[model samples]
Target: MQPISPIGVVRGGRRQVHEDGWGSVVSRIDLDPAVFDVSATSGLDAYSHIEVVFVFHLATRTCTGTQHPRGNTDWPLSGILAQRAPNRPNHLGVSVCGLAAVDGLTLTVHGLDAIDGSPVLDVKPYLPEFAPRGEVRGPAYAGELMRDYF
Candidate 1:
């Protein structure tokens, strides 16, 4: 099997900040402008949002496998595949962030929840057809807090 190599590294100041080993951090993505110049998206300002793929660099190997999750403690533990926990076997993170603006090959995005210096895997324009539409379904109480869900 081939090992996973990061396409790019995240540049942020996120780090372990809790005694419990948990933390809150923000991240920034630095993309190579030259890479985009050859593509149709050379003028990225045309899009309003972008999808970013990054690595959970802070996730220790021990954090992988299974977890009961915060509110679902009474619902029995679930394997990583069954949940959205960051401590997965692969430790990869994907998010769709609002496009604050596009400056040359540099893009300023909003709402990327990751630590600084995380490894970036890829980035793609957010297409409406690629995104979900209409009603969303999920565990009853689990879906609460629409704003904080992400």
Candidate 2:
């Protein structure tokens, strides 16, 4: 399969997670004006959140086997798919962020997990119907690992 090009680049924030958590993080998704028209996001503001599909441009390798989550030995060993690790076969990430505002070719978002200079593959409005239908379940370690992760 062929690879896809990014539609935009992230700006302003670094890859590091904040000590205060994701609440204070903010970043801008600057789409290529040539590829995306300003009108493309005209109705986007109607939604409170947007889903951002992006690439882990900084990821070095794909982890295919089982490993501890976040290198924490306390967490049970699991395959890459079992956890939301960035080191995957495909270095892609999807984050649902609060849509702060949309300008001509830039989208101001809150709580976007990506770092500055990350490549954005696509953007979609978040609809309630698209969320999971039932209760979400996971290992107890998953909760502990994400306790500080935004």
Candidate 3:
């Protein structure tokens, strides 16, 4: 299996600041091209957006159990497959970050939530052909989360 190490920190988003000086986990992610080398595709630049996958290294220790919706007590505790909590058995996170620029192997993207030195997993060009469409269905918490946060 191929291993991936983090190249640098991503800016943007207001993830929480951790006690260890690392910022809060992000709801999104941006990967570095200097490390990714997506240029081989030739059409990588054609897409304005792409998805990022990264590891939650901090969770390497006690990251366990599917959480109750961002650690809120009001939300019911759920299992790994039920919710998108990072504390799952794998501790991996994925998000679609907007590509601002791509210079050779160096890429600039927005909306990544990784801390200053988190490990990156992989990057893929988001193709519309592969996009999923249809009435989106999921948990009934978009409004609940907003109220809980605000």
On TM-score, the candidate that comes out on top is 2
TM-scores for every predicted model? 0.72, 0.92, 0.67
lDDT per model vs. reference? 0.62, 0.86, 0.58
- Flag regions of model 1 displaced more than 4 Å: 1-4, 13-27, 33-41, 62-65, 71-76, 133-135, 145-150
Q: Judged by lDDT against the true structure, how good is candidate 1?
A: 0.62
Runs in model 2 deviating more than 4 A are 1-3, 15-20
Candidate 2 per-residue lDDT over residues 1-150, each given as its tens digit: 877899999998766533337656888999998788789998898999999999888888789999998777988899998877788989899889999998988999998888888999999999999999999898988777767767
Best by lDDT: 2
lDDT of 2: 0.86
Better of 1 and 2 by lDDT: 2
lDDT by residue for model 1 (54-129), tens: 8878877545556766435665566777665677778888877777665555556666655667777787888899
Instruction: Give the clashing pairs for model 2.
Output: none
> What's the best-to-worst order under lDDT?
2, 1, 3
Q: Write the per-residue lDDT of candidate 3 for residues 6-54, one digit (tens) a residue.
A: 6434544444433221122233334455664555446667878777777
Error of 3 at 72 (Å): 0.9
Query: Of 2 and 3, which scores higher on TM-score?
Result: 2
Q: Put the candidates in TM-score order, highest first.
A: 2, 1, 3
